[model samples]
Target: MIKKLFLLVILCSLQVAVAQELSCTVIVNSDQVNQTNKQIFKTLEKSLNDYVNQTKWTNRTFSVKERIECSMMITINKYENSAFSGTIQVQSNRPVFNSTYQSPVFNYQDKRFTFNYVEFAPLYFNPNVFESNLTSVITYYVYIILGIDADTFVKEGGTPYFKQAQNIVNLSQGSGYAGWQQTDGNRTRWELVDNLLSNTFKEYRLALYNYHRLGLDNLVDNASLAKQSIAGSMKLFDKLNNVRPNSFVLQAFFDAKSEEIANVFSDGPKVDIVKLKETLNEIAPLYSDTWSRIKY
Candidate 1:
């Protein structure tokens, strides 16, 4: 009996340790990027927070009330055409507890059980170079990394939010520089941004379809389907790249999604289900991708 008691204590202590080890935050390195390009950083930051606040899946409900610490590290790459880009790092200390519970057996056999570990998925995003293309790049990363339900929100009349995001891109128009509406002659740079956004919407739809067809959550599972989906997206990316490969923001936007498409299958293309799992990763969470950028 004493041995069982000791085992229980050990298990409890282990749980505490595991919980303590799970810490997450977002870091941005803005070393060389300046105040004039601050809008890009702001847009990225908003998308990151929106992702955590809105994403649902995981079979575990995070404490929305609990404050999760996040930061950003921004740096200017002088060699890359004085390009401005940022990386978003997310760490979570709070244990994303599994809702599944095992019955407490006090006298059955004095048995001890090992703690089960849950896997966490990482975030990904590429920085945009051009101010005009920044909006599309930022928005794409938010959807891919943060898992925003862009289609549902947009279809639900989230016009105000979409327009606000558009405004961010439009701000850089004219004055001898490319704007959202301005034509760069044969360059078709603006057209590329528009195409990028259009392609992103398609990918979102594909993600939704895969989520529904295969009962999985996070990119850790069902990577093959993600690959196939991304492969299709690449066709679009290539077409757009041909138009304005020079646009850093545009190039990064497609590159980031391409990476995500590859990682979504990082855990392999299979989800666990003995018999009763939702047809489409039932725990799939819904997040409003445009809340930060849109007014409505």
Candidate 2:
């Protein structure tokens, strides 16, 4: 019995060590870069995939089925020497309760994402320290994605994770990276995390929890109430837009959700969508084209 218990402990330890949080697909696009050596991009893609997938990002041990689904597409606009200039579009989603359908949670592009890379240099994540711009950017988004996912499950559950990303932002400041400083563009990473954790944007975070946990997760039980909850969640933003006036966080929210919102209300059991549409147009006028798809 003693030997059997020892073997069981060894197996459990291996499983805990091997479990990873993110099942992220990393893509490197070099079409814009004029380089005959395409092998470097492929190598970089493989390296990034390995780095992101194999890393133990959190203290929580997640089963393989519980891993977060996300993707990162890096478009290399220019590559010269060992320096690479590009944009990274990061997106993530979560599974709905009692359903096979996955709900889209985050979708945003970092236009000022430029980073240096030496081919085959092993990537490491030191949360307390500032490393390469490439790793800092990637790690920042990983925490953001994790934070967003956590927010959907519990009220303000993502606070700790958002704080972690904030720490990364704090550490990376003045690293000569464009997206790391307050002076960087409004849509930069610094603004993204800062807005998320700010009380000024608290509605955005509440809406996230309501839309997912109370709305999508309960759709199978009572879609009418669920749709109403989702609409009520959007209504949380009515006064917010007036204050911030088309803020970066608001834009990012609509960017990821406009289509999904339209689809949810369009096909579901009718729920006073006329008022919902009005609210959507007022807050997210940029996605009015998508909002129009939601029938009265």
Candidate 3:
């Protein structure tokens, strides 16, 4: 009996050890001319870190710890033609637990552009509606990083961050009538624009947060809600595509989501309970993989 007990304890210990966590960072590089916008990148970095660490999961599901392997740097690069770009480099130790391990290294470089607040300003100034408007931004970008459409994420029942975002958006709706903005700091205030400018890039900031918080913790439970959020995110991507047909980010989202959806159908039809369960497990990895590639 004692030997059996010892074996059980050992097995438990192994399970705990298998559930390790990972950490990484982003570095943005640009020219001195772009230095003024550096803070935006920095803020985004901090937000990503926060999402990966604190967001709680539902039903005591997967929980990720933020064990920083090293400091992350964002560099700004400039060209003679008056062009500027941003590059992000992430370094981290892999998290291994229960035969599950992830060592994700993401590197991508792209031109830097700013999203004007005027396009969405009317909703931004309202305290109640702010989160939803913010959700719109993040939802749009998370799919872009994943090579999926904002509509896709919403359709898949997007992460918890979507609900939180909706709360903000709902709160902001009627509050703008009184010219009552400035509930937050200056940078946030400025992000709340309403005009012809596109919000495609701004979505990345929100996507990172949603991925970190929701992906790590598994805070969402109701599958229906999750699907709606994912669909909403996909719709935002569609909107971006309408404005900029062949944008790099939009293309990426389309490719990723299309692959993911295709993969779900590739395994064959689900005709029985056993087959359905098997298919569900197989499709689960697609969700994780899609979210993992997201730039935040």
Q: How many residue pairs clash (N, CA or C atoms closer than 3 angstroms) in each of the candidate models, in the order given?
A: 32, 0, 63
**Candidates 2 and 3 compared by TM-score, better number:** 2
lDDT digits (tens) for residues 49-76 of candidate 2: 9989888888988977789999999999
lDDT for 206 in candidate 2 is 91
Ranked by TM-score, top first: 2, 1, 3
lDDT of each: 0.32, 0.89, 0.34
Error of 2 at 292 (Å): 1.7
Quote each prediction's TM-score: 0.31, 0.93, 0.28
lDDT of 3 by residue, 90-193 (tens): 23322222223332312222222222222212322232334333323332222222221122223223334234433443354443321113453321312222
- Please provide, for model 1 over 157-214, each residue's C-alpha lDDT reduced to its tens digit, 9 standing for 90 to 100: 3233334344444553442333344355432334433543554344433433333233
Among residues 3 or more apart in sequence or in different chains, the pairs in candidate 2 whose N, CA or C atoms overlap within 3 Å are none
Query: Once model 2 is optimally superposed onto the true structure by TM-score, how far is the C-alpha of residue 271 displaced, in angstroms?
Result: 1.6
